[model samples]
Target: MGGSFKTQREVNGLFELTDSARNNLKNNAYYNDDLAPTKLDERTWGTYHIAALWVGMSVCIPTYMMASGLMAQGLSWWQAILNIALGNLIVLIPMQLNSHAGTKYGIPYPVFARLSFGIKGAHIASIARAIVAAGWFGIQTWIGGGAINAALSIVSPAWGAWSAGIWVSFFAFWALNVWIAHKGPDAIKFMESWGAPILGVLSLSLMIWAVTAVTQMGGSVGDILNLPATYAPGGFWKIFLPGLTANIAFWATLALNIPDFSRYAKTQKDQFMGQLLGLPTTMAAFAFVGVFVTGATSIVYGEFLWDPVAVVANIGSPIAGLLGALGIAVATLTTNIAANVVAPANGISNLNPQKITYGMGAIITGVFGVVMMPWKLMETAGAYLFDWLGTYGLFLGPLAGMYVADYYIFRKKTLDLDDLFKGEESRYWYKNGINDKAIWTWVIAGIFPVLGKMVPALSFFSDNGWLIGFVVAMIVYPVLMKNDTSSLITPEEEEAMNEKVTG
Candidate 1:
């Protein structure tokens, strides 16, 4: 039973629960300090902060590898950059749509899902996001560790020569990431606000270095850049369609869980304008840098060096090596904490908000990251792009569609903030805290992508899994939701509930 609040307050379309309401909700199993809505004063992230967040997350090793990965699949340098731009542009629509709910309601992704997926059933979205985030957390940690190991190796010959040094660095870096994440969202915001500028400078410096090195080696950066496609196994569309899907899938997870960051945003315009200015442009620009640098690598080393850490390590000056190593470390750290840590920490905390604190959830996420053995996941460019990304995009894309449809079409962009925290007493608490309509809709939409992955005949569906899943869920969720009023509250009902809580 929810208690009456002493007063009502709304800021920039975000509802802030009064002290009375907060106290009443505090004892509920589903309610926890970490999972609660942000207060009016806490919503301080403006356009620059949100934009900087994207810049920090986008300029990572994975973003750096995106062009090289596509090139490995037989795309020319320009083709890869264009594909990355288009995919990011396509994904930005859903990213912004999902972000609306976060800014408007001041809720994280799991709590936002409660409107459509029900209370307990929201786990479907949260856990799915958590699984994907864990893998990414591991991959970034591994890359950061390699950078740290490289820097340490320069200082101490014995540490560099020791067979176990790399493992030592890996675990040490992993612990540091978990520790910093446990410090909470403010720590993350501080890192991103400060780290974005430094990363931008380092990325540009690397690109310039590549061009100068290639020229001095008496090889043409222009010639390497002009090189045509080397290995399109089936043809252009065969490589392209999947490459586009993989690129979209790269950030598809963020599309669903963006609220984790956007909840801190000050206004809808702040989040929207910030995301528009940040995500696509930074990704496209980074892809170009990656492609150009890799091209220069071919001229300087006579072999394609896809890994940026390896490229930085190859530079002879010990001081330059240290700086490059630190740059990679910082880039990986900023990305991992913002992109990988937040989703799972918040999602897993949704599981038992009473017992699992956000910091605890973050530590648990780190353990899961290690257990996933991300080294295996990064074995090859082909496996990373096609196998891992394509497979996950199959399910996540539909999730974005469902979240959009429920928020925009079915609910008309309205949510009762107080009821969202209730247990069996709430309208969102359908059928033992699960929405059968949403679960069934997700399964039905996901089946096609799953089949496509399994059956070679339906490989087109798998290749374009994210778009397929998104469209199917968009079409299906609305129809199912039309007749199912289980989660819907009429105007009268909403007014009454608001009065009850406020009185």
Candidate 2:
């Protein structure tokens, strides 16, 4: 939570935003629970637990759908898996870099952004990051609804065909997401820890089922394993390059907002080892399952089945389909709320912390999820794969780059927590309340990418847009803010400031 709105904001030369009494409240931005530093008592998560978080998020329908979409575009199984693995590993660098701020300083991503983007200007990045999360929330909700509809068919075929039934299923799953998020991070952690293993086991079972179905159709296992590429060698790299970029975009949202989760780390080793052990391997392995099953579909059904929900429905037994749908629905639910709802919810709540609680932030995310009309995207999920995921990465990458350069280069891994909360004028206050340099840097870096996305002839910029933006921001921001020492609050001053107020 931030400062209150009832009082007149005081300005005492260099410390208008640092009023101990007036801004003590979490009013101006993020929720008190979200923005504040983690207390010694609440920092109990360890290496395995953090790994479980990634595992739970990684082994879900969207992760599978991404790989399957790549295969649909004509890449072989190895090509698709390689891209996912490589992308995850590349994203891990910035993920770890951003996580350092949270683990060391106990601040969320939005707060961390304030260091580079100014206290208020950070909203630009925060909200931009949230848009992707909102998009994800809608996509996952749509997937869950499809899963629910498939499960419902086992009960009554008529119930599954109604559009009203689909809406009801969507809302019900939406309600489940809201309920868990309302329960807070503890409930989320519990779900991730337990849900990940269950989903992993079920994926193996799904593989077995697919292989059996293919064999029963008199198809050889060798054909599925050695599924030929539909793309010519030259054509494969054309799609593979953008496909790789899309894969990076898959978890790029998390790479930027990771501090939200990393803030809970008990030790630096916990975050480091956990993400290293969990991210790429889980994505590659789960994606392999999707690749194999989709290939099996080609053998058994004479066409590819990219949608996992449809794969479950086509299992040829009502009972088996029901079981698969239930598993998928549960997996999607876990992934949706954990991966999609939490970050944006925190970001919106950060905009006005005093009034908007975490639950309200979550509600905001849910409402936008509906407004995005994710069902339309689902109808041709493959077509939007590059457009939806790769495009967002263009901006998010710059935000991540600025944070890394700001924290490691300009600030030297040090920050004044007291200065982060204030509003008057400090080193972080570049102009009024916004860090114009950081804002301009991000904007300039992202322009061509956004343009490239819109203009077909500039596809080179589109394919490498995120990486280009990241490099430009990384180089530009530090050069612009080189002489600033406003954030250089000494440790003793920090202690005195903390002593005057509550943590």
Clashing pairs in 1: none
RMSD after CA superposition, every candidate: 2.4, 5.2
Please give, for residues 108-173, the per-residue lDDT of candidate 1 as tens digits: 988998888899999988999999999999999988998999999888988889999889999999
Instruction: State TM-scores per candidate.
Output: 0.95, 0.91
Cα lDDT of candidate 1 equals 0.85
- In order of listing, the candidates' clash counts read 0, 11
Q: Write the per-residue lDDT of candidate 2 for residues 1-503, one digit (tens) a residue.
A: 12222111211111112335334645544336567656444666799878988888999998888888888888888888998899889889899988987877667887788888887887888898888898889889888888898899878979977769888898899888878977887787677767776688779888998878878887777888899888876797678878877887888888888989987788889999999998988999999998998888888888888899989988888888898898888888887788987789888877876677778888888888888888876776555577688777888878878888899987888666655766664456667778788878888888888888889888777787777787888898899888766666566554444323222
TM-score of 2: 0.91
Q: Which ten residues in a row have the lowest lDDT in candidate 2?
A: 6-15
lDDT, candidate 1, at 158: 88
